[model samples]
Target: NYLWINHGWMGKKVKYKEEKFKITAIDGGWSKWSPWSICGKDCTHTKTRTCDEPAPSYGGRHCSGKDTIVTNCTGGLCEN
Candidate 1:
């Protein structure tokens, strides 16, 4: 028996006897960061937040970068 499959609008016909396929899930992504923790007594402290995205699945692209980030705390008393 023969089977014909249309490749696309191009009207190309393809013949196949049998085909194999594999599927995989993507990597997981970082979840939303918790509230910023209290900064140190010093004004020169750091604050951070995180992403809350789900991880990728089924051989999908994995989350590449960091989940959390930190920034200088310039509004604290220490700054004075």
Candidate 2:
């Protein structure tokens, strides 16, 4: 919880530098990634995650980076 109190000044204008209250920005967060799709046919698989874990709001920036990844599999070297 945050507490803020302002005193005095019934008819006065305060500059930005004089203001004591501040608004903090929030950053976005991502949820756990889904299991990689069974590497099949094309020997390729995919995994994904979303930013809904903590969707950006209140002037916050959206999560950066890709939400999905595609990986290529190989013989005798398939992902465990």
Candidate 3:
């Protein structure tokens, strides 16, 4: 029950009686990745890394594993 509207003197109507909020659940954030992209044909390469964070609202708790991760690069043997 909440209704508040007052504009100068042309509209005045206020009646509110609702106060009970207990929402808590948000645990998901990540932002630390962006330095592994430049290996797509050297000798068996494959690198990747990315993370922009921001993912968890109103009862959120996810994003704890991987945003983008790939490994396996040598670039030192390929020419036969």
Point to the candidate with the largest lDDT.
2
Which candidate has the top score in TM-score?
A: 2
What Cα-based lDDT does every candidate model obtain?
A: 0.60, 0.77, 0.62
Q: Model 3 segments beyond 4 Å from truth?
A: 1-15, 27-36, 40-54, 57-62, 74-80
TM-score of each: 0.39, 0.56, 0.32
Compare candidates 1 and 2 on TM-score and give the better one: 2
- Residues 1-80, model 1: lDDT tens digits: 56899989888999987665777565666665566655545644443433326656666676667655555565545445
Per-candidate count of clashing residue pairs (backbone under 3 Å): 20, 0, 0
When summed lDDT is taken over every stretch of 10 residues in candidate 3, the lowest stretch is 43-52
Query: For candidate 1, what is the lDDT?
Result: 0.60
| Ranking of predictions according to lDDT | 2, 3, 1
What is the per-residue lDDT of model 2 for residues 1-80, given as tens digits with 9 covering 90 to 100?
Answer: 43344546665544444447777777789999999887766778889999877888778888999999998876533554
Flag regions of model 1 displaced more than 4 Å: 1-23, 42-61, 74-80
Quote the positional error of residue 50 for candidate 2 in Å. Answer: 0.5
Clashing pairs in 3: none
